[model samples]
Target: MTRLQPLPGGLPERFHVAHAMEKGASRTRLRASDLSAPFHGVRSLSLGEADTILDRCRSYVPRLAPGQFFSHETVFVLRGLSTPEWPYVPRIHVSAHRPAREPRTHGVVGHRLQTREPAIDVGPEGMPIENAVRAWRQCGRLWGLDDLVAGADALLAGRHPIASLGDLEEEVALMGDVRGGILRRSLALARPGVRSPRETHLRLLLVRRGFPEPDVNVDIFSTRGEFVAEIDLAFAAWRVAVEYDGRVHAEDPRQFARDADRWAAIRDAGWDHVRILNHHLRGGGAPAVAMVRAALIRAGWRPGL
Candidate 1:
């Protein structure tokens, strides 16, 4: 773990500026300005994360409109709020004070504050990024799920925890978004390394397409209390088990043998099974929804009025 250098006055050191000068100086001829104290009087704040934008704009302070606050996106990066897979966009939101201008041309964006909402104070530096991430969670309700997820990704990848981002994402996801689905919340509940990537994708697709959700990685056991098989996705009442089979399953000889044994064990326990391939779920073949729907119908899923 990289120990964060203790910041001066609890403010992030301008690491971005330092990184930029280092890069520019490395290229053949260095400028006179680069030799001088380019960061004179500029208290460089480290966002506690590394990035190209952070490197380029290290010397520049975000130009904010009079009373605008930092949006979830900027705060997310500054605070380290999300998983590494999440994409980070360099933008900040400022609340619209007077009549909003026609999208100001600054690098930072001015997002109108929700009516009657006061600005939330982002805490001091050197405090765990998690605290700022909590503030980002609150900001997401006014913004959207995409922003929130992006924010969470930035924070988490930068070494913050998912727990610190809080539960607002789950709450909003439950309420449904433009697509009238709850993917955000479902993703929040997904445990890393527990489910195969294929299984996780299928589960998300089912939820997105409005299928009856299945229990992920449910356990199966014999009447004699012996463990039978751990299903990838299971419906207990229907006795249906959906397994996501990846290409690796077909390629690896050892994995194939283990899978054969697992399948035999499952069959002996008298459970119905349906295997879906990753290509089928993710590619342009029979759509994931159709395949799942067919399986459910064959297993006697009644249509609701």
Candidate 2:
């Protein structure tokens, strides 16, 4: 048996077999036990090593046909938006500019674009992908109203937004025949400065249960105009803040300490703060909503007033 040379570290996690052959790897070596054939003519050292959905998608980019760009959940992954876990869909999504036969490949889902739709762009990793707003609209086919709102909020968040709410609304108007009700509802519910999907979920739970929609990631200041803290969701007048604590807060010692201090400061400022954990958000968010509702009542918020 011929000895195989070790793969170079400079090589991407996934590469074409031809590239490997060019780098002096023999066909027999490319087919070694350590290599995986993720797509036709594409090889990976370890499929498990491609931990993220985007990593797995990038592995197959060299094999994508002409005029193809990622869309739907795949684009969600590419744009760094929140997405479902691997095996949720278990297929890479591709969208072609023109009508084409659905790819017969077992692990791929293909879509056709409408005429005169926005042009696709090459993403940071050189993979072809739809723009953020367009991709958010495309995702409506797969995601429900709440998930879509979360996606839109992510797209239009922070000082440097990838896409604006108006841009998303225009895309929805252009794609008239797709996901009508869910798209409109998501657009109405979507707000800027939402940092994560869990925040969006918590906000939706409150509003859906008839609580006045709280502002997203608003800053609360001390009486002397010093910034006390920026809260996840706040009913400013009511002085109630609803915060979603992801696992990172507990896992990172420094963050946990900072959060404790921040909570104490907010409490000292005469604001009622509600901390929401992942478990409180499960099911219908009854416990979390009840907690926020109680805080709101204490802060002088009434349902019909």
The digit string of per-residue lDDT tens for model 2 on 111-196 reads 87775554777775788887777777777878777888888888888789988888888888877636557898888888989999
Candidate 2's TM-score reads: 0.86
Residue 253 of model 1 has an lDDT of 95
| lDDT tens per residue, model 1, 204-283 | 56656666778867789976879998788886777777787765668789989998888877867767777787557545
Candidate 2 — which pairs collide? none
Off by over 4 Å in 1: 1-201, 207-211, 246-250, 283-286
Kindly give the number of clashing pairs for every candidate.
16, 0
Q: Please give the distance, in angstroms, between residue 13's alpha carbon in candidate 1 and its true position after superposition.
A: 18
Estimate every model's Cα lDDT from 0 to 1. Answer: 0.50, 0.80
Model 1 RMSD in angstroms:
10.0
lDDT of 1 at 70: 49
